[model samples]
Target: MAGAPEASPGESRLRRVPPAEVEAARMEAVRRYDILDTPPDGAFDRVAAMAARLFDVPVASVTIVDADRIWFKAIHGLEGVAQIGRDPGLCGSAILRDDALVIPDTRTDPTARTNPLVTGPLGVRFYAAAPIITADGHRLGTVNILDTKPRLITEADTENLADLAAVVLDAMELRLSGLRLLREEQERRKAEEEARTRAERDTEAITAFATTLQRTLLPPALPPVPGLELACHYQTDSPRDVGGDFYDVFSLGGQRWAFFLGDVCGKGAEAAAVTSLTRYTLRAAAQHHDDPTEVLDALNSALLLDPSMGSRYCTCVFGTLRPAPGGGFSVTVAMGGHPPAFHIQHGDDGAMVVNGVRPRGGMLVGALENAQFASRTFHLAPGHGLLLYTDGLTEARLPDGTMLGEEGVAAFLTTRTTPDAGRLIEDTIALITDLPTGPGDDVALLALSVPLAPATEQTAALSTARTLATPVAGAARADQER
Candidate 1:
C-alpha cells in the first residue's frame, strides 16, 4: 500500500472509460435531442413520479448526461436541485452499460463509497438506474431511483426501472419529429415567395418593352391642317404584345396633305418592324409624288427591295388632299389590297348617304414582282367626310356570330346627320368597344372633313361644291359604275 494514491471525495472506482470515438458518438446523440437545460414538462414529471411510487423510493429523476455534468430533465421528491458533477458511480456510470445498474448498499460498496451522494448531506445509501438507449445503440442518459436507507430489490423491480427508460426515449423521438416537420414547411413557403417575385418582375419588363416599340411605329399626334378637320383612333387587343396596325398624317407642302392607314400581316416584334417601315416609306414617297397612285407605287417598290421585310405583306389606303377652287377639298385615293373607304355625304333631300369607294384591281403590296394598284379622284364637297379604317372593324364578330362587314359599316354611317370628323372617331371607338367579342385584331381609324360655313355662306358653298363636282364627279361616277 506504499505510494498508493487516495481516492477523491467525489470520485468512484467503478468507472469504465469508453473508446474516444464511441464517446463522441454518444455525445452527438445527446446533442441531437437538444433536451439539456430546457424548461420542465409535465409529461416527464409524471413519468418520474411513477418510477418513485413503483419502487417505493424517496427520489427519482430523468437525466441527460453531458461531458462535465448530468442534467435532470425531471426530478421527483428532489426540490431546489437541477444538476450535479459527472460522478461515475451514479447516472454517468449507468449510461455506459446496456442493462440496469443496481447497488443495494452504496456505503459498503467500494465503487460508490466515495461518491458525493453517499458522503454528502442527503446520504443516499441505495441506488438503481437503467440507461436510455437509442435505436442506433447510443446511450444519452438514465432514469434513476435512490433511497436514504439500504434495501434489497427483486429482478422484477429492475425490469420496471428499464421500462421507465424506454418511456423517456419515446417522448424524445416524438418531439424531434415535430420539429423536423416545422422546419420543412418554412423552407417550402420561402421557395414559393421567391418564384412569385421573379414572375412579377418579368411581366413588368415585357410591358415596358412593348409600349416603347409601339410608340416608334405610329405618329405621336396628327398634324393640324388649315380649312380641314382630322381625327384618328387606335386600339390593341393586348398590352403585352405589339400590333401591326398603323396610321399617319403629314404635310406634303403647297396646301396639300398626305395620309395613310394600313394593317401588317402578323403580331409581335416582327409585325411592329414592318409597320414602322411601311409608315415612313409612305410619308417619304408622298413628298416626291403629287399623285396618290405614284406614292403607293413607290411604297410597293420599297417593300419589295428590303430583304428584312421577310415574306410579310400589308393592306393599305393612301390619299392626298388639296384645296379646291370651288369650296371643298379635291381628294385622290390609292388602294393596295385594302378595304373600301367610306364616303359620307348629303343627298338632294338633305338626308345622309354612305357610299363605299372601291377602286378595282389593287394587289397586295410586297406580295409580287409588279403588284398593281388602283386610284380614284373625287370631290369632297362641303358637309361631307371620308372615313378610312383597317379591316379589324368589319372583321369583328357580332352578338349573332356574324361579321360586321362593309355593308354594316355603311348602315352605321347612314345614321349620321352631319359630317363631323372628331365625333365620328369617338362614336366609332365606342362601337368597337361595345362589340360582343370586341375586335379580334388591331384597329386603326382616320377621318377627314371640310367644315361647313355659316348658313348664308353654306348656300353659296353648296353651289360651288356642285360645280367642282363636274370634272372630278365623272371619276367618282365611274367608281360607282364599277
Candidate 2:
C-alpha cells in the first residue's frame, strides 16, 4: 500500500507505480517463495554460472524482486555486489513482461540508455533477461545475463536463457513441496501428542484418540477408477489399542493404478509407527518403479535399514491394475509373506469360481536384509473380481472353536451371487458381524472389479456355484507346491 523505497543519491527512481492491489499480490508471491536474502544454494549458483558461460557474458544473476531492493539469490561474475536498487529499466522492468527482454546494446536503447548500470562505472552495454514466472502467472524474479561491451545474440540464445529460468522455477516448486510435507508431519505429531496427554485422564478420550489415530493411517475412501469398481473396509478389534493393518488405492499415472494391503507385526504405538512408514514407502517407491516386486523391495529396505523401525516386519501384497483391451483390467500382484488374495470369476455356465492368487516363495518384508519377493500376473476379466484381506479374517475363531482358514473363505465366496466389489465387502463385513465371537484381530479388506458388460450368450445361461483352485489347488496343495 505504501510507496516504493526512495532511490539513492545517484540512481533514478521507478517512474511508474503498479496498481496498489497488483503490488500487494506481487509482494505476497515473493513472501511465499521465502527466497529473500536466504542462504546460498548450490543449484541456484550453478544456474547463474551456466547462464553467464552460455551467453559469454561477464555478469549473470538469479534475482528476486523484493519490495525495496532486487535481491540476488545467486550471482556470477559480480564480486562484492549482493543486490541493487529497483532501477527503472533493469530487472524491475524485465519482471513486468511475459517473455525475455533483450537489449542488444543498453546504450542505444532509449528506455535504459540513461540507467545507472549503463552510465555508471560498470559501463554495462548488453543486457538480456527472462522473467521467472510462477505457474499461476506471478512474475517472481529474473534470470539475466549482462555484458560490459555491446553484443548481439540469436533468438535461440534468448530461448535458452528462458529455459534456465524455467529450471529455477522447477527447483523452487520441488523445494516448496518438501517444506509442505515436513510441516504437515510436524502438525500430525503435535496433534498425536496432545491426544495422548488427554487420553491418560479420561477413558472416553482414549477410545476417541485411538480411533482418530487409526483413521490417519488409512485412506478415508477408495478413489474411483474408470471402467472399474472399488470398495474397502477396515475393522479394528479394540478401540483403545491401535492396529497396524493398512491399505491404499492410488493412481500410478494415466489409466493405471497401484494398491496395497499390509499388517505390521505388533499393535500399539510402535506398530502404528511402522504401519505409517510402510504405507508411505510403498506410495513413494511406486512413483520411481511401477514393478510390484521392486516397489516391495524398496519397502523392505526402508524397514530393515531405518533405525527407528526396530524389530518391525510386515506381510504385504502390492498390485497394479490397467485397462485391458477386452474390457476388463489386467492385474499383476506381488506378495511378501502375506495371505493369498482370492480371484472370483464366473464360468461359461455362469457358475461362480474362486481361486487363490498367490505367488509362492515371497518372504516377509523387513525380516531379513536379503529378502526375495514374488509376483504373478493375471487377467481380471469382466464379471470377475479380486479380494485382498489381512490374516485377521482367516484367523477368526468360529463358535465351533476352529479357524475360518483359507478354505473356509473360498467356500464363503461361492455362496455370494455376484462378484461386485461393494457387495463382496458388505457380505464379508456381515459374515464377521454375525459371529458370536467377533474377529480376534484387525481386518482390512480391499476389492476391485470391472462392471459386467451387456448380457452376451456366454453370460445369459443359468448360473451355478463352484470353486476352482488354480494358483493354490488347495490349502495343502498350495503348501506342497510352494
Candidate 3:
C-alpha cells in the first residue's frame, strides 16, 4: 500500500493522505465559526497585519475555509479581494495537518508544484500555514504566510507565527460580542417612546367623553306654556368639558310657573355642582313667592351656606310667568347683574325690538351676606316675543380682541326671524362660527315668542303688540347688564 516509499527522497516527502478524508476535514473546519460572506472586521485585520511583520513574511491573511473556497477576512500583499477556491489556497490544505506545514520550496513538492498561486498569480515558491484553532480545539480557519522566493524558515519564525495566529482568533470573538450589545440598546429606546405616545392619546379621549356626559345634564326640552311660547338656547362655548350654564322650569302654585338661567364662574365638576344647586334652590324657593326678587334672594343665601362658596359666586336671572285673561302673559324678572333681555314685536313694518326697560338689581350671588333684589314687570301679548340671554353669546371674542358684541346679536335677529326656535338658534350659532375666532366663555340664549291665534283671536292685537316687545335692536350701554 505504501508503494515502495517513492524511489527518490524528493518523492518521499509527498506525505500522501486519503484525498477524500482530507477534503471532508477542510469543510468541517470552515463551518465551525459560522462566519461566511460577512464583511471585513477591524479586529481581524489588526492581527493579520501584525502577523506579517512579526513573522517577517511577504504576505499574511486570516483565511476562512469554505466548502469549495478559502475566503479571506483580511489580507496583506494580496492583489485585490483574497478569496479563491479550496484547492488553490495552500492554507486550506495545510489545515489537515496538526502542526504547521512549511513547504520550503513548492516547486520541489509534487502536491503544491502545480498550484496556481505558486505557479501563476502569487508566484509563490515558499508557503507556511498555521491553523487558527479556538480554545475548544475547533479549527476555525488559518493564519497563513507566503513568500515568492524560496527561503529557509527557522524554528523561532514558525513559533512566532503560531502565537500570533491565536491572537487573531481572540480578536474575532470580541468583534462578534460588540455587535450584539448595540442591537439590544436600539430595541430598548423604541419601546419607551411607544409607551409615552399611548398615554397621551388616552388622556385626550377621556376628556372628550366627559364633555358629552356633561351636556346631557341640562333640560333636554323646554315646555311651551299657553299664552306664551318660550324658546331657550343654552350652549357651552368650548367642548373642553362643559362649563356651568344651566336653566330650569317647574310649576309653581296658582297656575304660575318658575324659570331661571344662571352661570357659575368656573368649569369642571365643582362649578357644575354650583349650577345644579342653584337650579333646584330656585325651584324650591318659588313656592314662597310668585315674585322674582324673593326667589333670587333665597338662592343667594343657599350658596353662602356651601363651605366652598368663600371665593365663588354666580350670576343669574330668575323669572315668574302668569297667564292673563287675553292670550297674553306678564313676567316679573329679577337679575343678579346678568345680561339684559331682548324683546321683539311684529308690526305692519315687520318684527321690531325693544331693549329691557331696566336689567334687574343684585350683586354676584353668594358674594354678599345680605344682597338686595329689584324687580321689573313686563307684558307679552300674542304675536310678540321676548329674548333673555347670558353674556356668552354677546361676549364671544374675535382674533382682533373685539367681542362678537351686542350689535352682532341684534343684526343676527333682524336678518333671520324664523318660526322654529331651534332653527333660529342654529342660524345664530353659525354667525359665531363664521367669525375667525371667539371667546373663552360659554354662550346661552332664551327666546320666548307669543303664538299667533286664529282670526277671532283679538281685536286689540295690533296695539297691544307694541307694548309687549323689548327693543334690543337699540345700542346697549357697555355696562347695562352684560
Best candidate according to lDDT: 2
Question: In model 3, which range of ten residues has the least summed lDDT?
Answer: 460-469
Give per-residue CA lDDT, model 3, range 1-482, as digits (tens): 00011223444323344377655664565554456777876446655665676567778888876666778888876758767776545765555556676778878977677777766766888788787776655556788787888878888677766765765665555334334434544654565477977555554544454454454446655653544444555456555454777776557767787777778888765576566556656775687566788888877776774344555688888888777666666877888867766556654677555555346456677778688877788776676666666677788776787886777676666666543333454565566667776444666656555566623232211100000011122111111000
Candidates sorted on TM-score, descending: 2, 1, 3
- Taking all chains together, each candidate's TM-score versus the true structure is 0.53, 0.55, 0.50
Candidate 2: regions farther than 4 A off: 1-201, 454-482
Q: Which digits, one per residue and each the tens of the lDDT, describe model 2 over residues 244-328? A: 8988888999888999998999997668766766886788678768789999998887676434455789999999988888678
User: Per the 3 Å backbone cut-off, how many clashing residue pairs does candidate 2 have?
Assistant: 0
For candidate 1, write residues 329-417 as lDDT tens digits.
88988999999999998889888898888799878887876888899989987778899999889998889999999898888888877
TM-score winner, 1 or 2: 2
lDDT of 2 at 358: 91
C-alpha root-mean-square deviation, each candidate:
36.0, 13.2, 36.4
Alpha-carbon deviation at 217 in model 2, angstroms: 0.7
User: What is the descending lDDT order?
Assistant: 2, 1, 3
Q: Which pairs, if any, clash in model 3?
A: 233-445, 343-470, 353-471, 354-470, 354-471, 354-472, 355-471, 355-472, 397-439
